[model samples]
Target: MTGHVRPYRSYVYAYPHKTAYRPLPEPGPALRDLWRDERKDALSLYLHIPFCEVRCGFCNLFTRIGAPDELTGRYLDALDRQATAVRDALGDTAPVRFANAAFGGGTPTFLEAAELERLCDIAEKRMGADLRAIPLSVEASPATATADRLAVLAERGTTRLSLGVQSFVDEEARAAVRPQRRADVDAALARIRDARIPVLNIDLIYGIDGQTPASWRTSLDAALAWQPEELYLYPLYVRPLTGLARRTAVTDRDWDEQRLSLYRQGRDHLLAHGYEQVSMRMFRRPGAPAQGPDDHACQTDGMIGLGCGARSYTSTLHYSFDYAVDMGHIRAIIDAYTGTEDFTRAVHGRYVDGDEARRRHLLQSLLQARGMPLADYRDRFGAEPYDDFPAELAAFAARGWLDDDAPDGLLRLSPEGLAHSDALGPELFSAEVRAAMAAYAVK
Candidate 1:
C-alpha cells in the first residue's frame, strides 16, 4: 500500500536483527549488573548448536556444515564454561527462574546421544534451568533425528520437536538445494511420533521453483497424515550468501505473486482442515498440547542464550558473540567461541533506548494473528500505538490491511495484512536500525 506490495521482505522473529549489533566497548557490562534491575521471575533459556549435516540452499542461519567428534566435545566444553559464567552472573540469592528452554541450531540432533545428555546437564546442573520441569523444545533434521538422539531429548522432557522438512517432494527438495528423499522425511516424522513428544511441529516451505498449488496441497496433506500438532508454512527466501542465492535470480513481482498465491492456498487448505492460524507462517491444531504459558512473550521478558549463535536479551540490551553467515566466517566464529575461556562480560550488543523498545514491543505483538492489546501497550509505555504510529496505521488502513473490525482496545491485522507481515515488519524498523543493517557488510 505504501509502495512495496511484496509480502516478504524479512522474517522478523526477533526485534532488531542481529546485524544491528556492534562491538561493545572493551569489557562491556557485567551480566549481573545488566540483570540487576530486570525482572527475572520468568525468563527464557536458549542453547544453540552450530553444527548441521548439510547446508541447505535457502538457509542463512548461523551454523556450519559439520563438526568432528573433537569439535563437538570442545563446543560443549565451551558451552559448559559459558553456563557456569552465566549462572554466576545471575547469582543464587534470588533464585532465577526459567519458564521455558530450547535447543536450536543448524541441528541440535547432530550431537550424539551422550553429548545430548551432557548438553542437558549443562543447562540443568550448571545453569539451574530444569529442562525436565520446563517446556523444552528442540529442532531436528531428517538425517539427524536418530532414535538415540531423540531418546535423550524425550527423556529430558522435550515438549516439542520441530522437524525441518521443507518439502515432501524429493525433486522440490533438491531444487531448494536440500538434497533429501521423501521416504527419509517420512521416516523421520515417524520417529518423532514414536518419541511421543507432546507437540510435533513440521516446517514446510512454499514458492520454490516449480512448486504448484497441487504440489503445495500434496505436501500439506502429507504433513496432515501424521496429524502434526503444528505446521509452519515458510515462503522460500534466497537470502544473501545462501546456497539458492548463487544459482537463483527471481523477479520480485512474479515471485512475490506466486508466493502470495501459494500462501493463500495453503492458508485456506489448513483452515479448512481445522487448523487455526497462529501467524502467517504458523498454524496449529485446536487442542495441541500447550508448550508454555499463553502469555509468554519475548518482547518484554529477558532471555539467556548460550553458544556463539545465540543472542541473550535483557530489557535494555541484547548481546551475543559476533554473527556470520559465510561458511569461512561461521567456522572462524565457532572456533573462537570454542577456544574462549573467560566468558564473563558482554562484548558485542546494542543498547535499547525507550523509542527502540516501544518499536520492538509494537512489532512483536502486532505480528501475531492474536493481534495486540492496546491496554498492554499503553500500560507499558504510557502511550497508545495510534499516538506513536498514526501515519503507519493510516497507510495500512488505506490499503485495508489493518483490521478495523477487531474488538475495542484490540489492534489486529486483516487477512491481507497478515500476508504482508514481512513487509509491514520492516516498515516499522527505526531508520537507525535499517541504516545499521544496510551498512553491515556480510562477512
Candidate 2:
C-alpha cells in the first residue's frame, strides 16, 4: 500500500554456506570460569517449548507435530533439571536479577496449565530471583489460546503475549497451514484484553506462497482493527527442509515484490494508526509504557541459554547444542560451569572467530536503528570504529550508504540507508567481516 512493488527473481538456488559448528562437550570448570569473568547479572532467559499441536508449513523451528501429552510432561521435567544446573553454575558471583524471560517454541500455550506453572516455578526457584518483576513474554497460536489459558499466563507473570497471525485471508491461511481461524484470533485477542495484560504483539508474515498485495493489505487492515500494542512484520523465509520449501509450486511466487509491498504497506498502515516505527520490523503506539528489550538481548548482553537447541553467549564464546532434545548437551553445559576450559575455543568450535563482545555491541546498535557509539567502542575495545573499519566506513560514505554529517561520536544509519537497509548493512562491514559472517551463519 505504501511502498513500491518491484518484481525480482527469487534466489531459489541460494544456499547457506557450511560452517564448522560442532556441539561442545558437557560443561566443565572451564565454562564456569567464562561465566565468572563475564560477571553477568540481570540476565534474560528463553524457554523453548518444542511441542506444537500443529505444524505450520513455513516453520523450521525445533518442534514436532502431534507430540503426545506424556512426552510434553517429560520435557517439562528435563527443563527443570536444566534450569537447576544453570542456576548452580552461576553461584553467587552476580546476583541474578532477570531482565526478561520468554517462552518461545512450537507453541508455549500448548503446554498444560499446570505444566506451564511448574516450568515458571522451576525457573524462579532455581534462578533464586524475583521472576514476577521481570517481563515474561510468550508466543501463542490463536487456536491454543483459551480464556482460561490466557488468564493462567497473566496470573503467572506473563506481561506480553505474541500471537502468530500470518494472514487473515482463509486461502492464504490455508496455504501457510496456520492452525487458527480468523474468528479464533479475534476471540484470543478479546480474552487477552479482558485479562488486562499491558502489551500484545501480533506477528504477521508476508511474501508467502500465493500471497498478493491485496491479501497482505487485507491482513494489515484486520490486524489494525484489533489495535494491538505492537506489530511485527516479517518476510517469509523458505528453509530448505520445511514443508513450505518442499512445495514445488512455490517457485512461482513473487516473493521479492510481495515482500517490498508488504513492508511499505504495513509500515504506512501502522504509522497512520499511530504506531511509531521502533525498528525495522516492529511498530509501537506513541506513549506506550516502557517494556523490556526485543529478541536481541541474548546477542547484546551475554545470556546463558539453558535448553535444547538454545545458544549461549559470553564475552568471548558462543555455543549452541544440536537440535535434538538430548540431555547430554545439557549435562555438558553444566559441567562447563565448574572447570577452566578455553571458552574462546568452545565458541569457536561451533562458529570459529566470533567476537561476542564486538558482535553484541554492533548488533544492539543496529537493532536500535542507530550505529555503534564511537566513545563506547573506544572505552570498551580501546579502539575507534573508524580505526577498526576505516576502509569500510569510507567506502560506505562514498556510496551515500552512510551519512558523513552524523553526530561526531555516533554511527547512525541515514534515511536512505534505512530505506534500503538490507543492501546497505553489508556495506558497513569489511570484506573480511562479511566472509567471517558467511562462514559462521549463526542463525
RMSD to true structure for each model, in Å: 1.4, 5.9
TM-score of each: 0.98, 0.82
For residue 416, model 2's alpha carbon misses the true position, in angstroms, by 4.1
1-443, model 2: which lDDT tens digit per residue? Answer: 12342222221110111133354565423555656766557677777776678778887666666444376666666667667666766667566567778888778888877877877787778766455787888889887777777877888788888888888887888888665678777888788788777788898988776787788888998988878888887767666456676673544335555576677877777888889877566788676555777534545445666555456665555665444222233334323432322222233224324343454465456545555577887888787767766775675566555656778888876644444454444444434545654565333
lDDT of 2: 0.64
TM-score of 1: 0.98
Cα distance off (Å), candidate 1, residue 234: 0.3
RMSD of 1: 1.4
Among all candidates shown, the one with the greatest lDDT: 1
Candidates' C-alpha lDDT: 0.90, 0.64
